[model samples]
Target: MERAEQLFVETVSASLENKSVSWKEPLTLNEWQRIFYLAESHHVLPMVYETVFRCDAVKKTMQKESRNLLQFYKRMTMNLVMLQTIKTQEYLELVQFLQKKGIWMLTVKGIICRELYPKPDYRISGDEDILVDKTQFEKCHKALLEFGMKPVKKGINIGTEYEVSYMKSGSPLYIEVHKSLFSPESEVYGDFNRFFMRSAENPARILVEGTEIFTLDYTEHLFYLICHAYKHFLHSGFGMRQVCDIIMYSNMYGEKINWQLLLGWSREIHGEFFAAALFKIGKKYLIFDEKKACFPEEWRKIKVDESLLLRDILDAGVYGYEGRERRHSSNLTLNEVSRQWNGERKNPVLQTIFPSLKSMKNEFAFLKKIPFLLPAAWLIRILRYEKEMRKNAHKNVTDALKIGNQRIELMRKYKIIE
Candidate 1:
């Protein structure tokens, strides 16, 4: 890590752990600006602001030299309060409406995750995720539209195994009704069925704005969080905000969760290696307390390539935006096929060439209105996105595959995957 980032991490760790941060000398304006930018990118600016308020040296330096940063902090605090208020109200209304419709919705992440923060507003959330049963998905979706939430045309899903997003007309809250937690290509895709079943059996009811709503049970939620982070790690990258969520969640429900059960579940989903690495990172960077849960001695001690891991985390700035580079058309297509046709991996290229009927229709929504013109629409869709598909086709294949191979090798080295 760069020196400024290292210092930012150290300062955040001290603040989140409720320890005093004693800087040898007051930070320069430029150094403080860099720290602020890094914290913002990682979605930890509020937490950093709290630390700044607590430290006499930092507070004095900010007041004397970084007036703009202090003003930014003040503005952030105001916006945080307003946004939290809006989300809380929206959460209550959405829950009431869903309950009336008899839709089994289990809230995940977003405001629900923020409840685990030191201050509810410290962890900023852009959207609300509510998991609904596949059986009632259509009904729930229709109800959301009726309740004033309109769907965004693209980006949430390219296939069925993903969430559908909705936004209110004049509100900032973007709500996603999740049919499956992750995309088909994600490592944790196989575990969605098990998680859904678990959610049905052991629902966690949380009180939001005087109304009660359900969320994932502690163990399942923790495992999901790990898998969620791992998904980002593999694809683009994720930031410290995600890491902080895992640590805060673990700390909040230490004894309530059965670590053995979670570990076994993670292994069943091929997530044991990744989970262990995440826990180790959490401990090192977020200062996760060892007493929270009984982590496996061997897993905890599993050596990690810090340089590589940190690079992935930092590059995935605030929800995988920073490190999103285009891939070759063939690589992208192959990846999609492997994800969607997990059982038929022996011939991914062939499977991709002849996609399933439902998949084809969904990709070309025009087919829904004109069934007989499906083939033409399919051709049109490919033609429309062809330029996008071949964006990085000129890059050397070896270079494109190198990064993926390095990630796989690292995972193997840590025994995260076979």
Candidate 2:
């Protein structure tokens, strides 16, 4: 990492520990802006601002820039409070409704994750991830609708354990009701069945706004988080917030977690190398101690450049959509939507043309019970989404192919895919 980038990471990590930062050589306005942009892009602005705003040296150095910076910080704080409040209320209502319907549900990331942070609003999340049993998933979906959570679109990976229903409109809150931990096609963490089964057997209970809820135990959740980060790291990019989550999680549960067991799990998914890489970075910049971790020797010899990895983290803004032109779009292009539907299937075009069962259900809930109407429902979705799909027909296929190849190469570099 560059000296400035290293210090940026240092400052953000220090904020988590409530430690102040001082530089021997003062930073110029340009350097300060660079750090601010990196932090904002990485989705750690609030935490970074909270700490840096208190540093007199930083304030004095960035005097000309302080007004805008303070405005950004204050705006983020208010938005965070409102966003989190809506998410919490929606989450509790949805969970309670699901529970009343006798469908078991577990709150995953998002607001549920905020509890692990040093400050409640330190982590900002736009959605709520609620996991439910596959058998009861439809009922859970019905319950969600009954509770007024609207689906932005059909849930992808319908029958799979990792299907997601996005509540995008009609309400301020977004909820992703997941039936699986990871999709079957997920490269490293394809063993969603095992993770789901294990979680079912050893679920951990917690309180959210005084309501009892369950989630995967700390060790399982830690492994899941690593896998989640690894997935995003490969597909687009993930920022510091994800890294911070792992660090805070480890800080809170390190002693109780069985590192060896987690190591074994990482090996099962061929994720040990990436897991070790994250731990090394986390220890150096976030949390964990190098001497205490039993990271593999091969991890140290990984070929990827540290600077490139840092760039991926920063550019991958929240949820890894940074640098992608799609992030700026109000809605997904046909090709973009197709890319999501492609999953791990070899025939990307075919997958894009044919919607998943869950997706069909999102458009026509009756298909779940009637089954035979799925083909017709698929046709309807195709026609309904046709105009949107046609808008991107002129996009360069060659450029898309080039980006895909680059992603594969980067994934190989990080050992996320071979």
Candidate 3:
């Protein structure tokens, strides 16, 4: 059965890799039948249905796109299968255990909202997200340990310097213990807890096995999802599955979402402008607003730097993973350097550190000043970035120096006359 499931997953993945369910490929009956058969065999009937529905929507004459539809439907079917396999009792049991200790923890994206929908499988959940008081982190960690959930602290835990940012610890249940809701890297220069706590405003309380657990109120949950995505620039990939969940929740529980309250919460976490941008973009791309949620007067007054956010969103997506190389067309090497310098593209020290000759030439002022800097400044920058480079298995100052020398020699050969 496991082998069958694995084979089915691979086949479905291959099908979905064809990027045209909507625009071009019209899927055919044979493809739908194969997907449905696999989905049913795996008890993933819901996924099969979604894929079938998508297939029914395509135009058969659009031959290539029709083929894409077949593949996309199969992918959706497999995604539904993956989502349903999560332990339903994990949230309820954890809530019960914490309740025994008098610790109040509010659930976020992970499993809480996952089950909120009529068909939770449609939401496509990955990890369990919960927010708790800083004081309770140790207790939560201990409790999670009792349940045999381990912490997946791959990167250095963010904000470890700050007492409140101690977020980590996955469990047998497989979860991410967040000190707060947002990514620690992006959490800088912002007060995240205030808005995160405000999720309690219209909190959704549920009783499971005689214990009550509170989650973000439905409307607030949807708004939180939007803000979280905007924070990372809708580049969540499968994480956007959460956005789809929110849309389903919003459409399902329309009145529960107080637009004003949701926007107010957004303003507190991100500036009002950021919140406004999030709402506008969320409504624009994903699920839409039918009742037309009221925007604060301040939201209208706020200025949006689309160009700036576009760059940020692109950066976030480009380097979504650590040491992730961008596609060749994007100048992957330069993108890596850009992230290494902490997104300040023209910081002169980086030029000496990596000697990106092209970028240095672009920032001519930095170049002119670089020649005048004392050798000590050059040493300090190299030493600092070198120590940093030693941590990465990739190019260090030595590699850059070698590459730079080779370029100089090659330039002399080509008569480019560097």
Candidate 4:
């Protein structure tokens, strides 16, 4: 079994066994191996463990029977080791550089993921998800440049940190510097007041080897997780790390989170049910203070399988599908549409029909209620759109149509479409 995979199991077992783990040290090899076995027996190897570990270790440990699990992690950005080193080192540098620049940023996911394992080496990550005060983001970005860092994308590509992403390569690590915490696509994301009003001011935290790692208060973290999970799930599915994120974070900081705080954040984010479902799932795998919990009817209604679906889909997006192009267009591809669907920009008059966030959010709400209905609706829409697509699919479609009889002859001759 791979070390990180083993660590995931141990982390979960630590939760199950009610043990605490330290993520900055190495454990005995036996401890690592047994934990992987535990995670495997629980059937969470690929979906759960794959999120935090690097791929080479998977190859190093689980060679035969662990093939599928190994492959899955490889595809999901096999740069956990590189990410960790970069994050800790970059953060240390960023802290110093920003102090000189008089800018302060908080570390988010980078340290949180590592904190879940017995040592940073046992788990893996790809980026340092950091959050900075929106007002100071530009200054922070500027400060980063002085330290030889740059943002990963521009103009709404989105990063985990305030501005997000600066790379140095042949080296591992992508730093996601976020301006805000939630996904930009979320319904309330643009409303600064809403986030601030519901945000936790100075939540309880854990110290990892003297570095202060901050997280949402128990209730607050629950709120953020629910909103985030639902936000991602609505987009595709929640990434697998999200599930573990809720599991691990909630477990690690269970005492500080509370139900009322969760309710406030969820309502603010308009993800009340999402937060509830995540809380319900968290409770199953870990223990929380019952006195502080406010399990609702909705929470009990959410199935674990749904959570897993959200996790898998979300992880795929973060990690991306490498061989999708080679896999011939399947029924799902032709029928079900996503943001990645094929289409070209046309003149503005026609371009107004381009799908917008409102339409996507509406679709997301509909799917949550009748989750299986999306495929049929998508198929119907595909058949309707296919006609439009043929014209847009090729610049020649319209030109070819002008040839009249010759076009039909060629259509038949080429078998372009029945």
Candidate 5:
């Protein structure tokens, strides 16, 4: 790894472990900039900033570096903490409102994982993810609208999509109400939904700021974290924040988790090696202690190149939003996975130009009601893409294809594809 990236990993790992960074050399301005950008992109800026300030070396380096950058970090971190506080209160209120309306919601990912952190507000989340019973989806939808939250996509409801997003006007509080844990339309991860079919029926309640909220059971929640990371990995990539979530969750509930059962579920999804690699990465760089971790002996047998996976995760950033080309390249890799699973080879370019009706239904919800409008929708989508990427369309596509091929090779190395 490059020096900046190495320092970033060390700093973040130290922060998560509640330890001081052990860097001896003073970081140059450029090095600090790169490290800060990496922390920002990976959505761990607050944690990194907090940990770095506690280090004597970083403090000396900061005295020599530009103070403006330091101030920027301070401002951003404070804003994030404030936003997180507001969102948490809003989430508690919404949960209470939903409970009164006879809606059973299981909070997942964002809020649940946030509490596991040292400073809950340090872990910034874009939105709240809640899983509700399919039968109670309409009631949940109504409750959200009644709570002054508007649907992000108009006309989104049960049977139309796996999840519906809502945003409150004049506020940063966004909530994603999921009818199923994973989208059934997803060719690769659709099966993941089956694992959580009974999750809402028997959930574990936890208190957040004196308000009780429901969440998945310990084992299932940890498995969901792995599956969530795997989903992002197949798409583009997932960053260190996700890895930290796994580490923290494991640390808190290591003794309570059913490691064998988790392994079985992971193997069912062909994610055993990937899951093992994540834990391995955690132990190696993030101060995750395997001796105390409740992983099975089988995980040690799983051979995966941790460095390659770590590099990919760092490059991809949070949910692969770091680069446009990388996001576009994900189409090729995803298609390759589908082909391997379903024994069908789809030309990624053709698939992009002419998406299936089900795929088009997502962006053009009207297609669900009027199937005949697909051609018009396709044309509109193509026009939109053209307008957005008119200047570098060809170059971007070429680079995406090149990167896609490289990622496919990486997938093979990781045993995700053959």
Candidate 6:
């Protein structure tokens, strides 16, 4: 690991473990900047800033060297905390509203995971995820619209899309109402939805600030998180925040979680190796304690390249939005999954140039209503690509191809794909 990244891991580990950070060496301003940027990219700036501020050594160094940067970081973290506070209240209200409308909503991810942190507000989620039954999806959608949230996109329906997103014009509260946990249209992971079939029937209730909210049970919730992370890993990649979620969730509810059942489910999806690797990475670098972590006995024999996995996670940022070139590169691995599902291996470049009609329809929703517009949509897409490739496109494409091929090998190494 690079010095900055190593320091980042150390700082985050200390913060999450509720221990004080001890900086051994004074870092240059550039080094501090890099560390901060990494925290920002990984969406853990609040946690990082909290630990750094609490550390006298790092605090004194930043104060002596650059007071303005320190203040800026403080202000940024405070604003995020404030926004999160408001969002949390709004989310609870939305859940209550849905219940009044006779729609049963089960909250997921951010809302549930945040409570496990030392400071719940530090783990900021970009949006809220709530799962509703497909039968009640339309009613839930109507209720959200009635609650003054506007749909972020058009033509999204339960038949084709797994979730529909909404956002209020003047609020930080964005919502995603999911009819299914995973997209049924997904070629590689369409079967993942089967795991959550009975989720709503026996939902778990969690108390958030004196209000009771529903979520998946311990076993199913943890499995859902793992599956969610694996889904992203197969495409782009997920960042440390995701890893941290696994660590925190497992640590808090390790005893309650059904490790044997979880392991079996993971194996059914061919994600056991990936899941084991996550736990290994957490225990090795992120202060995750396997002794108390109630994992299956067989997991002890599983081996994974933690360094490679960590490197990929850091480079990918949160949900693999680190760089345009990197996102483009990840498409190659996604294409490999497409090939496996369809049982055809086409040239990557050719496939990119001429995507299937279904793929084109996803990009240009109009093509779904008027299939005849596909030709025009293809031409428009090519023109847009040409326009985007005006500067250093050749080098970018070369880099993407190289990185994508390397990541495919990484996927094989982790047994994500056969």
The 0-to-1 C-alpha lDDT of every candidate, in the order given, reads: 0.67, 0.64, 0.47, 0.47, 0.84, 0.83
The C-alpha TM-scores of every prediction are 0.78, 0.73, 0.52, 0.54, 0.94, 0.94
Residues 162-254, model 2: lDDT tens digits: 566557355677777776766654323355347657577787777867888888887888888887887665555577888778867777766
- lDDT, model 6: 0.83
Model 4 lDDT-worst window of ten: 326-335
lDDT of 1: 0.67
lDDT of 4 by residue, 66-135 (tens): 5554455455323444455666665655555665677665566556656665455334555666667677
Candidate 1: residue 25 lDDT (0-100): 59
Which parts of model 3 have CA positions greater than 4 angstroms off?
A: 1-49, 53-83, 116-118, 153-172, 183-189, 197-202, 206-212, 217-223, 234-242, 252-254, 261-287, 292-418
Model 3 TM-score (2 dp): 0.52
Task: Give the Cα error of residue 74 in candidate 2, in Å.
Answer: 2.6
After best superposition, candidate 3 residue 38: deviation in angstroms?
Answer: 20
Q: Which parts of model 5 have CA positions greater than 4 angstroms off?
A: 62-65, 155-159, 345-349, 381-389
Q: After superposition, how far is residue 15 of candidate 1 from its true place, in Å?
A: 4.4
Residue pairs clashing in model 6 are none
Instruction: Judge candidate 2 at residue 48 and give its lDDT.
Output: 75
Q: Which is superior by TM-score, 3 or 4?
A: 4
Between candidates 2 and 3, name the one with more favorable lDDT: 2
Task: Put the candidates in lDDT order, highest first.
Answer: 5, 6, 1, 2, 4, 3
Give the higher-TM-score candidate: 1 or 2. 1
TM-score of 2: 0.73
Q: Write the per-residue lDDT of candidate 5 for residues 1-418, one digit (tens) a residue.
A: 9988999999888887677787666678888899899999999998888877656666566554545677788899888889889988888888888889888789999989999888888889999999887788888777888999998976554567779889999888998888888877677788798899888777887888888889999999999999999998988889999999999899888888888899899888878888888998998989677667766677777878788889999998989888888887877887788778767667757876777776667668788789999999989978866775787757877887788888888888778878
Residue 288 displacement in candidate 6 (angstroms): 1.8
Clashes of each: 2, 1, 13, 27, 0, 0
